[model samples]
Target chain A: MSELYQQAIKDLAAKGSERLAVPDASSTLDNPLCGDKVTLDVTTADGRIVALGHVTKGCLLCKAAATVAAEQAPGLPVAQAAALADQVRAMLKGGDAPALAGLEPFLAVRPHKSRHDCVLLPFKALAKALASF
Target chain B: MTQSIRSIIPVLARAGFHYLDNAAMAQTPGLVVEAVASHDRTARANIRRGVHEMARRADAAYDAARQSVAAFLSAQADEVVFTGGCTLALNLAAAALAEGLGPGDRVVVSAAEHHSNLLPWLMLAKRKGFAVAVLPVGPDGRLDLADLSMIDGRCKVVAVTHASNVTGAVSDIPRLAEAAHGAGAVLVVDGAQMVPHGPVDPRALGADLYAFAGHKAYGPTGVGVLWGRKEILADLPPVTWGGGMVAALDDDGIEFLEAPHRFEAGTPPVAQAVGLAAALDWMGRLDWAEIRAEEMELTARLLAGLAEIPGVRVVGPTDLAARVPVVSFTVAGCHPHDLSHVLAERGVAVRGGAHCARRLMTALGLDEGCVRASLAPYNDRSDIDALLAGLAEAIQVLG
Candidate 1:
């Protein structure tokens, strides 16, 4: 239960509606159902991500996911962020994932399987943004 | 309107409706399923031809289906022309119009139109060099009715959606018709969102062309109806040519026949048509006013619950009066996608994002978009409760 609380907090804090700054690169993703989207921007210094920023006009989940990704992605190496995203995917997909050690805040999300893609939207946007550059 | 019937639908069930994300498709009545399967085999033969028993049965089934849709919509059997879906109906109108357009003519459309309603006009405008007049919508997703003044000299046709698929705002078609008529322009309506939930009188609305899909109306997919006045159809060109659309083929070109058959190409949908007919048959038994009343109740509950959450702003009008139950909104703290996910997890189904109304969203100052909860008549009390409960849970957990 404590783990669930912590994960939920971290998960809840990441919203795509709010702009969060990243170290490098930029990207945007769309959610077609309710007509919402999140735009992610980042700046990379050296091999490390140094800043993250975002602007969004969507609902809570998109804004929260962006905020969380912004807060978490800074100081995370580009490769590590990529790896972390995969872990987050595993954690989001299954009941148990060791990569979720830092993702404990999102543990309460197990029941929302259909929305797994929405929760992962920020990372996908960031990845797409970075990949383009 | 009555109590005995209300308790039987899925919305009234304890488990609620989203486990399968399928309403009519899920738990299709045993008899209906069997009927569909049996008719599928029987309908393989040609209609209005062939003396075989199989062909006769197929023709009977097809005719029966068309009659059913006609009765359900309160239109004559000749009014319904089964197409792929609502998009096809809109496309057909555009195609017919395209045949006559030489250039310099203007087409008037609304900014709040869904892609299905807007794209065809855009394509036509681009290809034909016809001026396109985009009607504006109010900040709350209502049509800027004054824009009707823009329908002037150059306007050759008016294309508009009866209701916005995104904001659920119902446009005043009668007023729009008056403007179009005043401008001497033909009025075309995209009824995809309007026909299923509301009552419509094509003649009363004074539209030359009207189209809608069966899928959203609790009917089968791949079947839509385009209702055009007989005179208008007689004057307009056909969208496709072949099999069903032809009257006679000989030396100097071909002569086309009457409506419906003129627009339909190849072998008609047959099975889908039957399913749509069945859906329409069932729909006729319903008291639409009661359904609208129920939707209003659900809309109120959904709006109240959404409004209670901080940073959660419901888009569209605050008044539930003129609008249907399709609700779209954005949140200050959460992205609609994220919020939709949270709700999705809780077993509540909703749509999020721009809802294919980019111009309307842009005009409303919502660059990203909003979350939408489109309520169907099948949605009852428990459905609304579940949605509210899920939203509250999402807000607490994420906000």
Candidate 2:
């Protein structure tokens, strides 16, 4: 039994379903190795993200990451959200976990280097979407 | 018997590594490793146009390797051109063949081709102004050549894989060969997946050209073979140019050597080629019929076991007819990567994802890709049991 697929991750992955038909900015990213894709849509106001939606067709790690992004990104400044993504990226590379409970479950993914991108795909998409803002 | 074969490969001696990733790269035997090391130690010198004794020895070793590859393909020594790998070999063929094509011409390729075999022609078509017509695959993952009109008068070449790396379904090469020849187009078969299993005769398969990699056939990496028909190669221009390929050079112009030499550019992978030849020699001496029977038996067992598992859907042909030992499947709720990770924890080595056949994956409706377990001669019942047991645990853990 791998700790990476714990009940908390599975619950978050099951909640990975929110999409905005129209948004101020949107970006799609794919893992060229496995062909897993994540498309994120964002709407911002007053230099802060007001709403976020994502359509992720990927593994549990990718879905869980997207769910966490959707849950924590709203009502936060764009730069802070970008920082969160960077923190997740840093944590996957053996750095300290992000100062958020949703992302703490992904600490088990640190050693599996190939799957680091799975946890970072939505975060990368979030950064890309925020960059357009 | 399997233990004896396993003993021949140094890496397989490791106790717990159940390697089911032969489709990516097979384990190299000790004979091939020694052949490469011995060549690098004793005969390491530039090939062709050298007066030293070391260069003479290098030339002899390289020429002998070419002859061995020729024998493996049932081809002439002058018809084989050694390339960096299978991708380069296919690119060499595509670039040279594209010269005869134009805007209105068409090149027919199957949907089951690896990216290496498909991308070169697609990229060449964009630059050379030719149309690429894709042949669709049936539900069983075999090419559906029912509509022969795609190979009409404008067809210039028919490029396809001899066996699909993802689905393991073997293509109907004779039918494809007849169609290509009927339309006055040449048939180029990507034999990378097929050659590792056994020797092949390109002429017998009615292919004008064939390409395969050495690393996938229990040989060293960085070496591959591109075998073409004598007359067809004689007429094609060289896609690359370098020292050994030029027979005469001046300020006015340059005259190239004949077919094989004209296509070989730069210093080739001499030691890798020597290792490939040694691998092929070892394969030739094996009882292929017995090995193939054992492989098919395992395939049958795997298929039956997969069928009994709920939510496991096979992506290729279900039976032992016209397929290799490669098996690909998908679980309903579990992603291939997740399942692969779980299986890895159990010491099972399998490949997940598109397997470099994205077009086929799209056609098969595998949005998240599928898990693939490919078998070689060295694998035994223990390997399959480990794979099945690992999958059960993976589903329980991830599903």
Candidate 3:
């Protein structure tokens, strides 16, 4: 197994915290190609993510990505989260990985072009959730 | 014979690449490629339209290709219509038959059919206000011919695949034809998968119409064959009308040519047809008994290796006699896409996702789909071994 797959499995096994209470914004995103779905709920205070939770029905890669995003979302400003999502997208699309600690696990997915969507789907959902606010 | 076959495909000589996606598209032989290139270089002209010598040469080559394809399928030249591909051939057949169908008429299709066979009939039924009935398949993915009571008198056409693309299960064409004929319905057989594996005699199989793609049979892409019984071909209306198809263009209406010519409206893929003929000729030269034996051995190895894997579950029949060399399976903790990616990284090529047979995927209860490793005559024991090793590595890593 590649290092990315092992780390992704580890992240997937570690569950995120419970759902956010009365979130200010939420969004649902689905990748129709493989029927992978990710829904994000975020509670923001003073334009910063105070709490975040997500539900995902997808492959291990997607679940792992979502878990990482949800775990790191708290205390980050909404703008930074949105920017991080864009950076993740670029990184998955063969670009050099940015200096983000949580996103280091996804560096192994750079060689798999077809699977970039799995790693980016959760980020997209989070971006959408932030944009709604 | 296997060495000769291997010599024709250069990619097979590569050190590490193991190709197992033959059911989706077979690797073209060197001779087929050379034939098409030669035709393009020497006899490049539109067929059946000009008085120039090049045109005549092109026309003769195209006609000869039609004859070769006819002989390949055990049909007359006039009974074979050159199509864009198998999907178009099936759509044309469905549309031509829809002209005679009415509100009460029904079309019966098997559950194991690819979307190419099922969707066209469903679309035509929606447009013509006819009913579309699905013939159920067994748990093994083989169509159940015993309970074909659904093909009643109201059924106008019975379209089915000669073999299931996913399960590699060969349907009993003769029995299905008998049932359709007893119900007074014409039978259309989708031979896309079957034609590539062996000889197909539509008449002996009792099919009124047969469709197959050239690329899937080690030929060129963009060319397909739709062979219909003479009487049936004559009665079915032309679905395409244009340049070469018209006999006369009057102010009131247009007169079309004979059955096959009338169906091929625009300029056809002449070089592709010739390449297909070359592929057929090459296949004809091989020893079938040897090829079948080798394929059986490779298939047995694949089935046994996959069965031994902890997380892998084969989807089709367990017995070797019940299927061709195509094998589909799912891993316990791995998604098909992820598994396919891992396999590809290890220099193995296979297919993932519903394989254009979403209904069959649903029937098999594979919500996330499965990985398919299909074999061709060029594939051998080494390819199977690579597949097994890659699969084991994938399971150890993912499971």
- After TM-score superposition, the amount by which residue A38's alpha carbon in candidate 2 deviates from its true location, in angstroms, is 1.1
Q: Judged by DockQ, which candidate is best?
A: 2
The better-scoring model by TM-score among 1 and 2 is 2
For model 3, the superposed segments whose C-alpha errors exceed 4 Å read A1-57, A72-90, A95-101, A123-133
Instruction: Give the higher-DockQ candidate: 2 or 3.
Output: 2
- For candidate 3, write residues B153-217 as lDDT tens digits: 99989999998889989888898888899999999999998888877899899999999999999
Could you give candidate 1's per-residue lDDT for residues B41-133 as a string of tens digits?
Answer: 666676767699988888888888877876765677777777888889899998898677747788989988888788888887788788788
lDDT of 3 at B169: 90
Q: Could you give candidate 2's per-residue lDDT for residues A62-114 as a string of tens digits?
A: 99999999988888888888777788989989888876769888989998999
Two-way TM-score contest, 1 vs 3, winner: 3
> C-alpha displacement of B32 in model 1, angstroms?
5.4
Docking quality class, candidate 2: high
Q: How many clashes in candidate 2?
A: 0
Model 3, residue B169: distance off in Å is: 0.5
Model 1, position B285, has a per-residue lDDT of 71
In order, the Cα lDDT scores of the candidates are: 0.71, 0.91, 0.86
